[model samples]
Target: MNWTVISDNWLFFLVGAYPYGPLGGLLLTLLLAVGAGILATLLGIGWGLSLTLTSGHIHRLLQSVCEVLRAIPVLLLMFWCFFLLPIVFGIDVPGVLTVIAALALVSGAYLAYAMAAGIAAVPAGQWEAAQASGLSQRQTLRWVVLPQALRIVQPSFVNQWVTLVKDTSLAYIVGVAEFTFVANQVNSREQVYPLEVFGFIALVYLLLCSAVQALGQRLLVKPS
Candidate 1:
């Protein structure tokens, strides 16, 4: 099925108009996923902690908001931010930035819930031991609790991250030339080789996801 088309345009598929146009393609996909995932990881820490640490209305409110974010689709959030922000706030949000924001906002909520669960999974004795050792509450969480909790949640975080990477294809709907977008563009012109082109697309996604999953499994291995 005309494999040369794939072989010929591999660079474009990987990098997209780079060195000549806007930055995009698989590189952009990874960038978006990494940027969004880091943002989510940091924010999730706060949101998640509020679940277990905070109380009263503040806790309920944070929980509600995170739940709402989790309920909404990423594409809807992207549309809201990309279109409404500029028109309502008089801000011109870049397309790539909007995708990152949307992905982070939604996925971060899940990460927050995962993080809270991870913290809960740590035995009560560990908390007591830290307290008996005279570590302050903040110090206990910062130095003792979070590291272990992070390790527990690492696999879940990696899963979310890989999903975010695949979701970057949505950027194409708004004109960002991400991996899927580039593939679609190429396919439209050389319509005869859909299988060869898209087959490569699937392979790229499989490799990226598999590598991430393997990394997570490696982290699960106990240290000697």
Candidate 2:
């Protein structure tokens, strides 16, 4: 492996065309993942909880919307967000933000179902006990249900987060210049170290994903 290629171009891979150009690179990758994770949690869990707790018109409407989102491919979503967002909404949206939104929608679609399963896994007695204690339905959900449901689905949420991290690679198609994109650029320019450069890229992704998994597992573990 020509370690020097990575050694020399590490900064570019880490931060991309920064301080001189729009931000892009592994930093952008993290930004995209984190941003998407937050948005996905809000959209996915909120919808899941609402659907589980609600019924009739509200549930049917949400089910239809999420079903449509889930049916659309993530790549198509990214393209639509980038190309059509401005035209349809008549407002500018940067490429990176567009990618984040797309990833969030993709990840959230799956997460919503996972959250619903978690909520369903909660026992019926727990709901009754909360009501027996004179807690409102909202209070019961907030204090008793959410904690348990979210905890039960911790592994799934973590998996979705890791999946989103990997999906950041797709942003390259739209010129996001994240980790994979920057690495590819360096390899192309140098043209002598595909194996070495890609090997380094794999290592970086491994480290990133491992750290995330470790932290998630730690959080998911039962208290002693």
| Per-model TM values vs. the true structure | 0.93, 0.94
Residues 46-164 of candidate 2: C-alpha lDDT, one tens digit per residue: 88898898899988998888889889988888888888878999878888888998999888988898899898999999999999999999999888888898888988989988888
What are the per-model C-alpha RMSD values against the true structure?
1.8, 1.6
Against the unseen true structure, what C-alpha lDDT does each candidate score?
A: 0.86, 0.87
User: What's the lDDT for residue 122 in model 1?
Assistant: 80
Q: Where is model 1 poorest over a 10-residue stretch in terms of lDDT?
A: 215-224
Which candidate has the top score in lDDT? 2
Residue 69: error of model 1 in Å? Answer: 0.6
Candidate 2 least-lDDT 10 residues: 215-224
Clashes of 2: 0
lDDT of 2 at 110: 87
